[model samples]
Target: MVDHLIIFTRYPEPGRTKTRLIPALGPEGAADFQRQLTEHTLRQVRSLQQRRSLRVTWCFSGGDVAAMQGWLGSDWDYQPQAAGDLGDRLIAAMHNAFAAGATTVAFIGIDCPAIDAALLDQAFHVLEAADMVLGPADDGGYYLIGLCRPVPELFQGIDWGTAVVRQQTEAIAQSLQLSSHLLTPLNDIDRPEDLPLWDAVQRQMLSVIIPVLNEAGNIRPLMEALQQVPEIEVIVVDGGSQDGTAAIAQTLGARVLFTNSPRACQMNAGAAAAAGGILLFLHADTRLPHDFPTAVRQTLDGAHVVAGAFDLGIQGARWGLRWVEWGVKWRSHLCQMPYGDQALFLRAETFRSVGGFAELPLLEDMDMVRRLKRVGRVAIAPGRVSTSGRRWEKLGILRTTLLNQLILLAYHLGVSPNRLAAWYRDRNFSK
Candidate 1:
């Protein structure tokens, strides 16, 4: 039978609500946005609850639960958010709800603006038989998590914000023999760029390999950063870099391979030479986080898991990066998909297993990820890799976002690599 629907939320305050966004929108602006967004989401959930016998419970925190009583009105139930990380709170609420005679329970957040009535209905409908149902967010987290029979194992031992949240949960479920279902995806905006495609979060990940040319000055720092993580293996394919890139690579101990012109060839050569079970084609300027090795190693250890990447950050110390950092990292967690600049990592076996880097002048990453998904799961982790945002800063945000999306569309529609390469060159995006 369908049970209670829990709306997981925290009090919308200036400092507490989405503090990461504060970097871009400031504290007050972020809080105001949170207030409006939460109100909108509550309205949607309220509308959904009206149709079914499903009980609606407000799991609130960061302030008195009583404060939301007036906002939600007298009919709905309100419960304070327990003190703990996200997982602890969720588990506590679910346990309480079940103990209080709820046979099935569903939990959701207020961040996904596009989540509407129909999706929530489906989640309830599916839970009648399924042990669990999840509405996978484009950012990697689930918008709605519903469970009919309690699977306590599902709630334990996860890197909550990492790409492995869903995968890890699924593993626990399988090990316990629980049945589950998945709903169509929805986007949750945690970044400024997300404001545009907030509606398309359900779509799939498009892997795009970006090759670096004459990046002699940038290569070492990036390689050194990658090496600190033992799980990641560096493969540098130089297109005869005259700036002593090869010599530098050898000096730093990165596996350097020689290749002819074309970033595609370089990437393909690098993939051919990569020794790790997964090949990560990173640009010379990118800097990944410290925990990436553990994340990638854990992913490789999973069954039906293929390839993935981390969230994006910039190379230097820019205060403006705080927003990008939050946006990229949160989006990676919610969507389970990472950007190429995040230094994409995949099973080395899966890389060769799926025929590594396509010889595409542009959008090779997109091409490869599409193939990778078919064999297993791909994810975006909370860990971040810093890339050169100089191109975006110079080209203008609107212009760069537009150009890349257009190229992405063209690539997905099967545009010839050569033609896209021509278009890419015209844009003059610097490495």
Candidate 2:
């Protein structure tokens, strides 16, 4: 017999969902928090489903079925929550699950980030002996509730959002002589004070995606440096490199993917294969600081920030390169436009929502930054990503700078990226 997992969540509508956090996170931020929390919880549930015979159902409020499906894809069951208070909805969901042939049913909310596959497995295992299972929240409410069969009286006449929720439920269970199992308590993201729980979870993983072309010399060193960083997934997308770049990256423990030329295509390919929640796009020649993961997380912690990049640090002794770094710093901070070499990072959801990087021959990073600015702040992290200054040194700093400006100006003046790419290639080849 298959068990059923019903997820309780609301469609993340600004000013509607997670209203308690709006004072601190603002409407958009609160909605985004809800979005992230729901997705995080689902990831855990999906993990459990992979190893067990569990059928998943999404019972949501505040948005229609189409909207929910559109936001989260249309693969699973999506049910609009029956209209009522929390207890009434819980009763209806439990009844529906039992009526539909569920051997055991468990209900969980989206607020708890600590509910992983292991915890969920324990909940189901406990239900085999106990009539009921409840995962308590540190706030005195329960994050999860499971039942072997329908027990409507367990949810009756209980205070839904108050501290006495779990207590009252357990008291009811005791009155009915139902044996209940309590899982470990976990903190939920309900108020401003509880936001740290989500932050801690988000800092656990960072996926660095590097796009390279024939940089066998640079790939090994970059991959080695990335290997030293904890809690990171390194993906090297080689653009048909002939200099053994892909082989070197594979040997150095980086997940290497082979894609066609053009940096945009390679980065997008890496992103598609990445499993982490946070994505960092780095140039093959750029080296991130040792604590880059912390820097990335801290910068993205801002309520209104959607994407971020590190400050540029060109590795060279040339005095002109210092000026180049200075200009890049001011532009990144003031204009909120950091080029790809500076190590751009953001939530994977945000990156996908912006349609990843446009597959253009040139100016794809600038286009991405401009599109991201329309959604939220494109922040610059305090730490710097040291990048090779070979381009400037090879073509003379002043000329290269002027050429970059000219290309940007032409791009804004309706120049096609293909033509711009051709002109840029010719200029670099002639130089």
Candidate 3:
């Protein structure tokens, strides 16, 4: 049974379609924007991994099949929109799709950029459980409307282009006793006002750069650990480490940069000097778990993901240390707050846009991590970095956990940073 996707697109000619957007974008600009919108929509649809039973066809309207064809590329199958009102065109399209041996049919307009594999999956999921599914768009128009078993009565006599589009569909479905499911509402890229937020989100991926300081004790050990992986260049930002941290890192085949520190300052400076697709912030004392390169590659693979870190572990096997590892992983997964000790990875652009790490003496890692979560999926992978537990061992696990949780609570409650710092200062639990 062929599952069908009908993408409804009007001709992208000036004075033909999308009139309201013209006042802001002008005729030529509107046409260009529409072309981009159509292309983006097509690209997203094309990226849908080939489902064995699904076939996609484009339904073009406004009597410019050639223009639509040019925009969609020659590979896509297209049909000119059959006449009547908007309802008639859609009804005809759905019936045509059904005629083409499609047991299930879905249609989308050339708008929403947020449309992705996940939303399409949801649509199919709903079709499995219900007779029909309607994806309500933010602009009062339904972006996607699908039917598994046709109830023509469900589509008839409905108000089009009004806020009641979704509401009336539900009413009809209820009145006709047709099973229906509603997909989550998503914003459509209709107006220029929406561009900045989208652009900011797109810019959030940043490359990672690690700046090392006073690391003669840890540099070679960390470098050797990193060398087990391939294609990852560990850029070392050296803050005049007289202990030969820079030389050790260079000898281990890492790209090294000499600089001065106050820790955060050196990291931010290194970020400025380094070259990579995404920047990962690493502590000199921490060592990554196995397959670290693969983990980094996965996190940076897509545009939707902004930054990610792994679960954390320490080099030792104390019971308390294991408990800490479990606790950190649980909290990171539950809240998506993967902290720096685990390794803070970001797309290079996002890191620069956010102005790198705030030059704080303490909590810079946590603060950077918290800000990253706002942009995209801040995920924690199954992999982990085996960091040193000396801090916890010296302070005692109970005291360290209590103090960390207290600081975390205070931070979330918006306590003054100065006061928090003072509180941290007064308590001298060994570092």
Which candidate number maximizes lDDT? 2
Off by over 4 Å in 2: 207-420, 423-431
Stretches of candidate 3 off by over 4 Å are 1-208, 240-242, 413-431
Assess the local accuracy of residue 392 in candidate 2 as a C-alpha lDDT between 0 and 100: 87
lDDT of 3 at 131: 90
Q: Output the lDDT of residue 68, model 2.
A: 80
Query: How far is 403's C-alpha from truth in model 2 (Å)?
Result: 21
Candidate 1 local lDDT, 51-85, one digit each (tens) = 67788888888767566754444567889987777
In model 2, residue pairs whose N, Cα or C atoms come closer than 3 Å (at least 3 residues apart or on different chains), thus clashing, are none
lDDT of 2 by residue, 1-431 (tens): 66899999999999999999999999998998897677667657655865687888999998889988666656568888987889999999999989999999999999888888889989999999999999999888999999998999988899889999999999999999999989999988899999877776775667889998889889888877765554466788988888999878866656678889789999999988676779999988899976888888898899899999988899899999999999999999999999888888999889899999999998889999999999999999878989998898888999999999999999999999999999999887221
- Please name the candidate that would achieve the greatest TM-score relative to the true structure: 2
lDDT values, one for every candidate: 0.69, 0.86, 0.72
TM-score of each: 0.47, 0.57, 0.49
- Cα RMSD for predicted model 2: 11.5
